[model samples]
Target: MNKSTFNTASAIALAAAALAGPAVAQQATAVEEVIVTAQRSSQNLQQVPLAVTGYSGAFLERSKIEDFNDLRTRTPSLTFEQFAPGQPRYTIRGIGGGGGVAVFVDDVYMGQPSMSSVEFVDLERVEVLRGPQGTLFGRNATGGAIAFFTEKPGSDYRVKAKATVGNYDLKSVSALISGPVSDVLSAKISVIAREHSGYAFNETTGRDIEDETLAAARAALRFRPNDDWDIQLNIDGSTRRGTAPWWDLMIEAPKSAGKSNPEPRRGRNHTDDGYADIDNAGVSLNANWDSPIGTFTSITAFRNTQSHNRANTTGLLVAPLSDVANRRVNFHTLFIQQADQKAEQFSQELRLAADLGDRFKWIGGLYYYQDDGVANRLTDYRFYGFGPTPVDGRYAYASTNETKAFAAFMSGTFALTEQLKLQAGIRWSHDEKDHTTVASGKNFSGFRDGGVSVPGYSAASSADWSAWTPTASINYQVTPDVFVYGTISRGFKSGGFSDGDSEKQSILRPFNPEFVWNYETGARTEWFDRRLRVNATAFYMDYTDLQVSVFTQLAPNLPAVLVSGNAGKAKIKGFELEWNAVPIEGLNLYGNYTRTESEISALISGANNLAGKKIPRAPENKFFMGASLARDFGGMTATGRVDYTYQSDYFSSINNVPSERVLAQENWDAGLTMGPAGGAWSVEVWGKNLANELHVVSISDILGDAFANYAPPRTYGVTLSYRH
Candidate 1:
């Protein structure tokens, strides 16, 4: 259905329920309480004014959610796409990019989107907050924020282990141990190892197009000298090596473009070498102190990460790029590329929370972060009869980025009456970034004329920016079981230098910050003796100075470069609904839906007139529903669950090219578990993508060729778990 229809349906459903609440009310078992920290404080989900979706560690395991990609179907208004392993793109209400969302592990921020896509093992809970969160989450949170809380050391000793064997030769083992070391100390450790021979079969190479090997470990130590203070230290590391799926040339090139139209095939590749490797490690320290006036918290962290990727640049083209005439060189021939990147980051945060009597509560914090990174790329066309010299089709590019940031934030809530409350928060942040780049190449690719006269070029640039965002919210309890709230908040995303182009495009300097003002209203209700819970939220956002990449050629007779700038304006609106019911004992049902509409109102002068184009990756309609049944059989217990998800079509690029869109698709997954009552072990059998549907999750159009990545096929697995 269209956006209007979807939105109307949502409104009618919510309004009807509110009007007929008493008629539908009945006696039943109450649902469990859901607690969240989306507001920087622990509160019942129903009492919070924000839109958040939370999944507990137990829920995650039962749902077979191994990573963020698998978590998408269980949540509303969330989607993921990728060009390669570890290079993930997430969209929320059509407002996502490099500077849209922020990810946090415990209190430590992961600076890059790719870094946040790691496996979600050993997590206590995962929370997703929708809308701009700049007032409290600092920079780069225009769309929203995702927070992952890891399991902490416990007061008692415990041991847990799990193993799984799945289709495509997939095998994994994970273990966790926790124990008390002394009177005042406790420690916990978790480790996981997994390997998968991917499902993508290559037609030309006779090999699997994608495969993975992964290992991760985390250890935590906690010290509690007394009731007034505590400290925790965490160390985590992970390594991944994989052969990423090869791209499919979907839409054929036009004959008028002087290129042959090759048929598209799934999991087929002509490239001989394509692989990715990544390593990440981090350390975090947290301390908490309680005083008569307030509670103080400090979080300090440092991280190191590195990655390498190798691929064929021309593998998707039908014919080699060359000239059979004058130079006897084919520019369309094989072009292999390699990229390497390494980064280091450090962050510190201090926060104080105070409870002034029972009517007033406040929180304030200060944060600082630093990042340094370098990336280098090399492209070679020697196999296409070209030498290693720049004039002979060899190219190299290198870039470095250094960033420093600081912020201060404060928030307070006041109970004006027994049923009404007022909340206000504001944050001020400053950011500085330095960028340097060097490029060396002959310029033999594609141009009406010979490449530039220079064999090498270099450029350096820097930028400093600051922003102040404020939030105001009002909430009122209509009844003991229902509440209504409204909020107006501003969010900001810090801009940085572009990395898509070489020094030849010096005009692609530093970009400016992007900002959004969000206005939202919502209602949370628990009816039928608390057996049914429903929450609905509607939001309107005004976005300005949006950072967008424009393809352009800085000089005549040269190829185009992707230069980013704050050059767009847009309007975004959406509605979300979440509902759960436990109408009968031993049975539970839960579902969520979202309707979103986004329009690009303006763009830069030289860019295409995309004023009416739909935002990329934002589907007009998304829905999910699931049911679980549990029962006792003598001395044993059995549980079964099934879920279905549906999403509308969406474009992958801001250009709104027809070839870069993914069609609507639906997916199904189910699981069954069995274990003896009071036993320490259980077994689960699960299947995902049961329908074996083939769909594209991402697509791109480059040089008149349409390339895309497909979602995984059907897979089934069995897992065994034991805990003590």
Candidate 2:
């Protein structure tokens, strides 16, 4: 995926992406202002000092964002993939993990992969923080964070209801009601139900690849006995049932390419329909105390999640097992996987802040977190049939994993001068995990009558890691509306054992924890009477044993295991530029661009040289822009906006080979909304992938069964919303 330096292809792609984002003329009006708290304090989007992106309730409706996972393509610079398929696999600037991404629900961490099941329905806003977040927050935040703010109790008594219907026979209902329980207390409750027929049909089986339904609810109470003290408690839960298919539809090449050659030129098409269910519940308490010395805050949270899913890969209609050529006789056409997991986490934090003197002010905090979890998976493989007959052999793997973790952290800030400030922080964290695998006792294809005889493997292993990380930052105000800053920080991620000898050990590595040191500089500025603002940052990071995940061929019915290792010298440097301006009444414009350079200086034996190449999932260039106009007529308001995002070609695998074949696609989404202020609500229509262009995303390079995943197709929908 590395742009070929000194080559015409790289130059052309860069030029095209440079102009990818829209360049709009300033305008006026925003769709119900977006609010965010990237700095740990509630504030309007425009007032946040960091690079932040907030989507208001109104915007979410227009974008057809139904669940928490739908936020992927709706936002620029955001991309997600399920390494484990139904999990929250978040990647911002390609910064998440193979284990999944970090999710923050109302400032509390999800803690583990399965815990990401937190639903996004009845939410007030979603904020995406786009870089290392060391100044605030907790957990493995090296890649920044995604915050989902559920509906909260307001100062006024209110009742709101919303509903929508769309294709796939999709229908939804959401409502929120809040009012005073007494003079000193208030409560709010919100709920949502989503039902859809799913987007899958079996041409031969007379079945759909997908069918799913879900419902979720939340209740919260706020007690403000006085201005100096307040308490808030929230309880939420959700349940889902049916198959949520993983549709990575591929366009197979003409039969001429030959089934023997599963290459880019000769394609083999295969996909799967799977089922999943999830039940989740959580409770949180937030209490604040205002003292003359400073402000004291206490937060305690507990959550539990149970999830299950079943799916098959590389399964297609029964076909010839022989006459397949080099790859024909040994490959598998149908394989199934089932996973069940339970996760729970509890956390508490106590902090104090105050303005000590004119030259010095500080904030300090004590934090604690614990995680306990278990995950079990079973996989079964069916090989090229002996003319459509099912056989029994040695092929099935079942594995279980147990995990635990704990951490403590604290930090403070000091104003060195009227125009200068400095901050420092440190954290100590520990994690432990154990894994075991047993033979599923299922027969294989060649051994018995049914799929038979793969010997079950019984093995167990455990690993633990501890690390101390420190962070420092300095900021200087250069002008009334301009500031410059620099930061030096460290990031750590623990590794697990991967004993290729066993199924349970094959998927994960028992390697030591990886650490990274980062140095950064950035600037924030505003000019033209606050009519325009810009923010940008760049950084260089050094890695020692930076852990990475790569696919490794395993046993029959079992997909390639995800391997971990300390890949040598790697570096990532990127810069982001965003501009916001309003040149005149009724006109608003925004544009942003991100350019990243990534390289792997070395590779393990038998692995291709990825040195000087763009890291997998790291796009060399990304751009976004939007312009909207607002007009008021007879007390009603109308608005229109168009946004575009362009990404340069990227590699989907670890190999840096030139002919792997990934595409560069530019997508645009536009919307229109009209409504009266404080009235019923608004009506909107929106479209994504407006050009209806085809794009290639990830591709498997395993030699015998290669395939490519495509991006979403052109989709358009209409929405209507009410305020109360």
**Per-model lDDT:** 0.77, 0.62
Residue 340 error for model 2, in Å? 2.0
In model 1, the number of clashes is 10
Angstrom error at residue 430, model 1: 0.2
Q: Give model 1's TM-score versus the native structure.
A: 0.89
How does each model score on TM-score? 0.89, 0.83
Query: Where in model 2 is the C-alpha error above 4 Å?
Result: 1-36, 39-70, 74-77, 83-85, 117-119, 242-272, 319-332, 385-402, 439-454, 497-509, 554-560, 605-613, 656-662, 693-699, 708-712
lDDT of 1 by residue, 21-52 (tens): 11111122566677778887788888998888
For model 1, the local distance difference test gives 0.77
Candidate 1 Cα errors over 4 Å, as ranges: 1-29, 256-268, 313-337, 379-392, 443-453, 502-508, 552-561, 605-607
